[model samples]
Target: MFHVAALGELLIDFTPVGLSNAKNPIFEQNPGGAPANVLALVSKLGKKTAFLGMVGQDQFGLFLKEVLEKNNINVSGLKISEKFQTTLAFVHLDKSGDRTFSFYRNLGADMMLNASDVNYEVIKEAKIFHFGSVSMTEEPVRAASIKAAMFATENGSIISFDPNYRPLLWSSVEEAKKIIGIGVKLADILKVSEEELELITGKIDVAVGADMLFREGVKVVLVTLGKRGCYYKYTGGEGYVDGYAVNAIDTTGAGDAFLGAFLYQICDMKMDELCGLNKNDFKRIIDFSNAAGALATTRTGAIPALPSIDEIHNIRLTR
Candidate 1:
């Protein structure tokens, strides 16, 4: 049985091909989208995983599908839309390898996904259902994603959400906050970045941001702090794990890698076991996830950068 089922966008990212050139800055195509990247990481960790989303009946769509298959992710729930084009994002990375996105989506195929397109049976079979806030930026897809999360919860599946909070994709920051808050309330596990925490709580302190989220019904809150590692907090627990020191090449998928590892660990344990996990157990899980995120930053791209289970184990063993 698949441990996790993720639903959202699967698109192509055009990253700079080489160092910035005066004449023309070439670009390379990479398979991306937060949910899809998480799916890839889960699969890389030797976990049973599936992805449910829509892609266009285009070459880029084919590329995205191939990427999922190559990573051993089940793509049976993937829908192909003939009327719309696949979504695309142009990613620009500064010298520090920090990224900024310029998206080109006009009711793209990914956002065209409707509730009818979802495979409710597959979602019911998974231990956890994971998603992100990007799909909430639009209409039918937003409704569809919320419906899926609700159904997953009703069927006893743990819901994990990442309020990935891209200001560019949203109509306004206030609107994004409102909608994302709804998602956080519905999720059992919530992942946020430092900037996302500040935006969501208007607080610079991570502890305060996590406390606010816990009060709103989020059972667990993970704050990814890039190089500083990640912070994990729950209703009755709190801790910080220092990140591994690595030569970070690109940080595009680090957060997804971290979330994927965390979800996989939770899914591997029985629901009753998870409910009974002690603070020590939670710390170990978050520490392992933090290492996964750090390793991802040492590589390029998103899906291709995720570490395998053996790699994660070896890294931990050495440390």
Candidate 2:
């Protein structure tokens, strides 16, 4: 059985490389999409992972499949679409390594995934099923994602949700809130950025926001605070873990790497044991995840930037 199975977008990210002699920007293609990035890191950590999504029968799509295979992620559920081209996102980065995105996804292949295209057996065999808000922005794919999540939970797989919201992808804030809330209620493990927490809960305080998520049916809430660290709250325990210091050149996949690392560590743990984890147990997990995230930021691409087990261990050792 796969340790993690993720259903969502798998697209090409055109990240900024540098300027040409004519002062025009140059871009490098990278395999990204929050769910895919998370699986890549988990597979890199030697976990069995699978991806369920649609991509165009194009160069970019083929390249993404190859990347997933290289990372050892099973792609039996990945479908090829002849109707639409692969989705593309141009990532703009400031000096601080923070990023903004411009997407080319009008009727993208990823948005065309139908419920029938999903392989329920993958979800049935997975220990955890992961997803994000990106796939919920459109039609067929949106319905497909929900179906997969429901099937997964019914099969006793843990539901992991990440509200990796991009404002440009949504029609309105209200719509985003409404649809994302569905995933919130379905999630057993919810990972959100600090801004996302405030968006969902309308509260600035981490403690209050986390409490609100707990009420929304999330059993665990992980709030990422870039550079500073992360805050986590579960049914019986809560605390913050400081991030690792690094000369970060890009922050594109940092959060995905963090979540991937966290899930990788706990994939084999039973639900009761997971909920029973004390402060020290969480501290070790978060420390390792924080290091993975910090290390991811040190490089330019998502999957390529993910740190190895040795690298993560070295970073953690220094702490």
Candidate 3:
């Protein structure tokens, strides 16, 4: 059985190759999508992982499948749709390596997935079921993802949610908030960035944001603070894991890497160990995740930038 199973989009990221030449900038193709990136990170860390989603029967879809297969993630849940085209995103990185996205996904293949498309057996077998908010922007796929999350919870699987909010994807901010709030209530572990927290709670403080999520029924709340590190709060405990010092080249996939590593670590531990973990244990997990995120920044692309367990250990040792 796989340790984690993720359901959502799988697509191509076209990143600008040269900063100086805007008019004639080269574009490099990379496999991405929050769920796909998480699967890649977990697989790279030597965890058994599977991905469930739909891709178009196009060259881009084939490319995404090949990437996941090469990374050792189970591709059985991936389906190719004939009616819709593959999704594509154009990513532009600023001087600080933070990215701005221009997406072309007008009813893309991924959004076409319905509840009928989900493989219940795969969800039942996994220890953790992870997903993101982008998949909830549309109809049938949104309903399918929510149903999957509910099923996973009922079947004794821990649910992980990352509300990777994109304003342009939803009909309105109010709608996005309502949908993401439902996810927050359903998730056992919820990850959010500073911007996402502000968007959801209209609060800038991590403590306040974490408190709001806890009240929403999330057992664990992770607030990622770019280079400063991550803040975590659970039932009756809360604290921060200081960030690792590194020269980051790109910030893409840092959050995905962090979430994947944290979940993988929890899965690797025994159920008793996981349940018995105290504040120190939580800190250790966050520290490892922070290292994974920081190391990811030193490299360029998203999936390719994720550090292996050895690399994470070495980086931690040296730091």
Which candidate number has the best TM-score?
2
Which runs of model 1 end up more than 4 angstroms from their true locations?
19-22
Alpha-carbon TM-score of each model against the true structure: 0.96, 0.99, 0.96
The worst-scoring run of ten residues by lDDT in candidate 1 lies at: 267-276
For candidate 3, lDDT tens digit of each residue in 18-38?
A: 745456878899888999898
Per-candidate alpha-carbon RMSD to the true structure: 1.5, 0.7, 1.6
RMSD of 2: 0.7
Tens digit of per-residue lDDT, candidate 2, span 33-75: 9999999999999999999999999999999999999899999
Deviation from native of the Cα of residue 192 in model 1, angstroms: 0.4
Winner of 1 and 2 under TM-score: 2
lDDT of model 2 at position 32: 92
lDDT scores in order: 0.88, 0.94, 0.89
Pairs that clash in candidate 1: none
